[model samples]
Structures are given as structure tokens and as C-alpha cells.
Target: MLVVFDLLYREYCRARLAEMQKLLLLAGESAKPSKEGHGAADQSHDEKDSLQQRGWHAAD
Candidate 1:
């Protein structure tokens, strides 16, 4: 029973570590500047329009 618990705990830790590493990689990528010069402004504008079409008011 102790051996089984240890194995399960190790597997859980490994999975959590992998998930954390993936998130760190994504965070690192997002921190880099956009190569096209335009950044969040362009993306936000498009998103705002999409939201309006979906009846998502800013005040709401």
C-alpha cells in the first residue's frame, strides 16, 4: 500500500510539473512583442466588434 501511494504521488507530481511548464512556456511566448508592429490594439478592436455583435455591452 505504501509503494502504491508513492507511485501515485510521483505520477501526480509529474503531471502537475508538466502542466506548470506548459503554462510557463505560454506565458513567456505572450510576453514577447508582436513581430508585425501592431499589438493588443488591433486584436482588442476586433474583439470589441465581435462582442458588440453578440450583444455584449461594455457596461454590462
Candidate 2:
């Protein structure tokens, strides 16, 4: 039981960390202004990254 909980908790923490990293990356990007309409595209790429990367929680 303890092992199970530990595994689940680890997974949860990894997911949350991945989610936070995605948020930080996106926030870092949005903090910048660009003449090109690439923000959406870049955000989409970040969204897709979580999907492709394991132990990641993708934001809706």
C-alpha cells in the first residue's frame, strides 16, 4: 500500500512539475511581444509537447 501510494504520488508530482514547466515556458514566451503571429503556434507546440512527453500533464 505504501509502495502504491508512493508510486502514484511520484507520478503526480512529475505530472505537476511538467505542467508547471509548460506554464513557465509559455509564460516566458508570452512575456515577449513579436511582430509575427507565432504565439499561438508556439503555444500549440508547447501543448503538443506535453502530449508527446510522458509524465506530463497537458493544460486545457
Candidate 3:
């Protein structure tokens, strides 16, 4: 049950991130900084590290 809940939460987060990205793009008329690393706070540290390498630094 716990594992299933985690999976569902991640999926929900991903979907919300997608929506936010679309909104930002439409508002700016251009791509936002990080196309793939939406919702970095909810993502794993390793994923965030990769994003950092790509020039993203999470808020401290």
C-alpha cells in the first residue's frame, strides 16, 4: 500500500509539473530554463544533481 501510494504521488507531481511548464512556456513565448527538471524539490537527489550539472541550483 505504501509503495502504491508513493508511485501515485510521483505521477501526480509529474503531471502537475507538466502543466506548470506548459503555462510558463505560453506566458513567456519561449522555453523556461530547465525543461526536464520540473518539480526538482520532489525529485531524488541524484536527479537534482544532474540538473545542477545542467546549470540549475535549487533554492537554499
Candidate 4:
């Protein structure tokens, strides 16, 4: 039972870490201006919209 719990906990931590990394990447992307001269805010909005279209939610 303890081994099983440990495995489950490890899996949960791994998944959480992956989610956090994704959120951090999105945040970093949102903070940068687009190469095409677009503002960071506009770029962020576009990214969020794209994520929403794909059924993914951006961190608030």
C-alpha cells in the first residue's frame, strides 16, 4: 500500500510540474512582444484565443 501511494504521489507531482511549466511558458510568451511589431498584450490575447479554440484555458 505504501509503495502504491508513493507511485501515485510521484505521478501527481510530475503532472503538476508539467502543468506549471506550461503555464510559465505561456506567461513568458505573453510578456514578449511579437516579432511582427504587435504589442505584448495583443500577442497574449491572440494566444489565449487560440488556446480557447483548442479547449485549453490560460492561467489567469
The candidate that wins on lDDT is 1
- Over 1-60, each residue of candidate 1 has an lDDT whose tens digit, in order, gives 999999999999999999999999999999997678577898898798898877855556
Model 4: clashing residue pairs? Answer: none
Runs of candidate 4 exceeding 4 Å displacement: 35-60
lDDT of 3 by residue, 1-60 (tens): 999999999999999999999998798876445557556564677686788877744444
RMSD in angstroms, candidate 4? 9.9
| CA lDDT for candidate 1 | 0.90
Residue by residue across 1-60, what tens digits does model 4's lDDT show?
A: 999999999999999999999999999999996578678898799999898877744343
Identify the superior model by TM-score, candidate 1 or candidate 3.
1
State model 4's lDDT. 0.89
Best by TM-score: 1
TM-scores of all models? 0.57, 0.54, 0.48, 0.55
Alpha-carbon error at 25 in model 4, in Å?
0.4
Structure candidate 1, residue pairs in collision:
none
Query: Which runs in model 3 stand beyond 4 Å of their true positions?
Result: 30-60
Residues forming the 10-long window of minimal summed lDDT in candidate 1: 51-60
What are the RMSD figures for all models against the true structure?
A: 5.2, 13.7, 16.0, 9.9
For TM-score, candidate 2 versus 4, the one ahead is 4
